[model samples]
Target: MEIYRAVVARVRPLTASMIRVTLTGGDLPAFTSTGVGDEYVRLFFPHGPDRHDLSLPVPTESGWETPEGRPTAPMRTYTIRAVRPEPGEIDIDFVVHEHGVAAGWAAAAQPGDPIGLNAPTGLYDPPEDVVRQILVADLTGLPAVARILENTPEHIATRVILEVPDKASEQALPAHPRARVTWTHGGNGHSPSRLAELVTTALPGESDLTGTYLWTAGETTALRSVRKHLRRTLGLDSSRFKVVGYWVPGSDTWTERWEALPATVRAELEALWEAPTDDLEDVTIVYEDRLSNLGL
Candidate 1:
């Protein structure tokens, strides 16, 4: 666990509403990654009368912990879009939406501005055994989806569904012969081809899913709904999919919402949303034991 200090070296617009901030500094040599494709870090934004230097927390075994009585810095998590060792820089992409500290800062970020970050950790990786893939995302998950596509094996069959606000929001992505990407755009909160519906339509029949994996990110409600259908309706095993929410829309109180889901739904989506890991040996054992008992 380590905290990093970076200076914004460049800002580039990826799309009409998406921005990329490239950070580089001497401290970047110490900035490392676990090399997992979905690795991410928390960017700390300085605030309040007592703190404005963008002071970041020191790392401990438990994680980065802030000291008591210091004004807490507003922070948001983002995926590691690119890591360049030659230039010693990392790229983080931001999709501008409603005003918030992270979005607002990115909207006006300039070269030489200060930012702090920690950890590029997550449990997502291309499954060695699975040769078929499905990727579903909203605007927030576009960067992660891009990373997965660029890194996954080229021979595997892959289908991608992306939800955006409009055509202006679609950006050019890397190409793969086995991949087909569809974009759904709307001016409203979700497009007509919403994440849940598009994923359902793309899921293969039971007989076709032997070597398949599904990765989903974005709106919590849509993602949870998809997870429920995949688990309870399609009877997909717990080991078949990996999921996470980019952000909960319109509210910061996520724990309250989690407390309200039906126990069964919560049980299936909870751990993946909270702490997904690529080491499925541990997860597979726990789930296999459970599945066998139910004759699955």
Candidate 2:
């Protein structure tokens, strides 16, 4: 994968737990992002007093290598919330939480500060001929969900189920052609499972799922439950459904469960990722809610 050295061009608060940062630099040229939901990027932030160190290596031999006894820097995974190529800008939405390096950096990011970015090497597109699209996710997966909603064809019926911490995070989604939007807020410190249950019950009737493409992403357990319900209970074709565990509760990264998926399933996903057709004729846009950019 190509690593880009980007400068913090802009930062804004989106919510108490989310921040929006726009980046620009020469590294962005190779980042030919197709649209929302089609890609994801990684953000690498500095650690400790070395925040001013712009001499870090580009993972190549010539760059400054890690000090013999120094600790590793902070890094996080985030979605490309928006991309503007005309001026060479890319926006990333980060969920701010305590003790996270990316969050800490975002909370205090300023223009001219240097950061590391890795270009997307994979794509997550559904089969172009699919008749319908079902998008499901939590805040972590919102950026991808929103992008898919914005770029999907109008004639292809789309349904989105987004679960947030509460009603306050429920922002308006970009209106897409022939799409139904559903926003579910988990109130009063409820668990992620609560959100999953709500989504399971609120899902459209079985009739709406035929010939539909299902995409589910969120906390690992929640994603697993939904995956079971859709494939086992509903008897949906496994080839048409995808469940991505963006993160796990009490864990810092995506689990290996995804890597252990059956070879058949993985092969199907690879096919979707490699598909080259743009069958959608129109794009739909939607937002759940806005939050203060915690600068992270």
Top-TM-score structure, candidate number: 1
User: What lDDT tens digits, residue by residue, belong to model 1 across residues 205-273?
Assistant: 454677888888887555655766676677776678877767765545555665665688558744543
lDDT of 2 by residue, 1-296 (tens): 45678888989887775788899875776677756474776666776666666433345544334455655556667778788887888888877766557767888889878887766633555766788877877888787887778878788888787888777676667788688888777621255345457556745446566567877777755554565566556766556776676775545432355465667755754555355644211110000000011110
Residue 76 in model 2: shift from native, Å?
1.6
TM-score of each: 0.82, 0.74
lDDT of each structure? 0.76, 0.66
Name model 1 segments beyond 4 Å from true: 48-52, 187-193, 204-207, 253-296
Residue 17, model 1, lDDT:
83
